[model samples]
Target: MFRHTKATDLLNSGVPIHVGMRYMGHKSANMFMHYAQTLSKTHEAEFLRYRKITTDGREYQQDPHEMYEAIALSKRTDRVLPHGYCTLPPRQTCDKGNACLTCTKFVTDESFEPVLRQQMEATDGLIAERQEAHEARFGEPMSQENIWLKGRFQEKNALSKILHTISAVRTSDGTFTPLRGAGSPQGRQEEN
Candidate 1:
């Protein structure tokens, strides 16, 4: 809910789409490309729920900004969250810009897979439900965004596996063991 509220508020407040993308934890604004689609779909859904359109409906043309207004008007009266903090490091200062692949935040290690998987599943479900409407409005399937998100998630997952293996092979005392050498310090030398 915090994410939705922040995203909705950002859209309504005229915050640049890129700023909202970062606030919503998107790796790239492209993954969050359907901001207008999201607003439009939610607005149309709510509008349809509250008012019935006639069978003799004529051509309907809405102002491009109508969806943005609807989002603001539908704002919940309650706070999005009771408490929260921004723990993520400032990325604006970094020069990576999603190309260098040097930022640790984007990398997955074993510790973050469960969280990543859960997030991926939730995102997939949300995108799936809005699929048809998004395509109709945007002339592109919402899954295109999902595909990019999933690719990033998978890249993180693969990096995590590699890191996990590297860590596992290290000794308790912090020394890395040689993979092909015989076992023990001297290897069958005089039964030492």
Candidate 2:
């Protein structure tokens, strides 16, 4: 019991795990885990009667920004994008406009797969049309150096990559790809 308490307190206090293990005189990670592990939360979960926490089961009662607004908070809310939402703070507008797929804070899940698919197909078609038009006007095929054309290709590729990750893994109706930053401190700090 004392071993468990000491381990718990040290670990919860943000002590390094290896350091804690050395302080506790444990060598193997298995033993360290055995001493530090606690089942209190898991044990308590058996008493939960209802899984649904809300009426519509959409997660929150209302948009979080609305709650902030009700309290007269000065915080800015997340901007909604076509596929997902931007995590960029109001102070820092994205310079890579229309490149949300490659942006650090551009979070999305399997739910947006349909929109992504449609967008990808549309981009592909548009690229082809634009290429033909460019060739006709310039008497040469659109070079890779064309900024607008290059950007379109990058967007198309990013969409394809995101779609591949989405389809490769799924949880219920949504699969969060590891690339996008959803819960990063940058966005959360601004809200506070």
Candidate 3:
């Protein structure tokens, strides 16, 4: 247990895997990887340390306790979704990858709007470049790759629209307040 914890801690602390393996006297990467696996709770704690949230036009590290409370509340209220938390059972599988923008299980709050918009812009740029290349290669009709890009762009556009519509209410004193109630559909038009 000590060795495993030490290995995981070292890796999580940004130590190179090869260095860790050397320190641990491991002969192969397989054994080193086994020791490097972090417990879920430990991983969550590490993730929270680096999590940043923008509030009141300033960025701040999220309070882990508050984040835990929010997650717990969201779970109890069935507000957890794919991108965030969702009502899905723990054992259920939703085979989505990092394509959260196209997942029907995705949920986003006002805090995530800026990131969503950024993603939309990036996707649009990629689609434009890919479309240009496709047109040069196959002039008359859209190629399969171009068609796929259009579909993904549409999905991202829809998500961006939904995020644009959900703004956090601001008080007279300039404090941002989250919307009341559990998570809303925000955007869930596609599945993984």
Best by TM-score: 2
Candidate order, TM-score descending: 2, 3, 1
lDDT of 2 by residue, 55-76 (tens): 1112223343433233222233
Once fitted onto the true fold, the runs of candidate 1 whose alpha carbons sit more than 4 angstroms away are 1-92, 95-105, 136-192
Off by over 4 Å in 2: 1-78, 170-192
lDDT of 2 at 76: 37
For model 3, how does the per-residue alpha-carbon lDDT over 57-136 read when each residue is reduced to its tens digit? 22233444555555564245444433343323445665755555455544444545556667667777877787788778
Q: Give the TM-score of candidate 2.
A: 0.48
Best by lDDT: 2
Worst 10 residues of 3 by lDDT: 178-187
lDDT of 1 by residue, 3-98 (tens): 566677676555557788887778877765554335655444333221111111111133324422432334631211111111123333435443
RMSD (CA, Å), candidate 2 to true, equals 17.0
Clashing pairs in 3: 80-85, 80-86, 81-85, 81-86, 104-190
Give candidate 3's root-mean-square deviation (CA, Å): 13.3
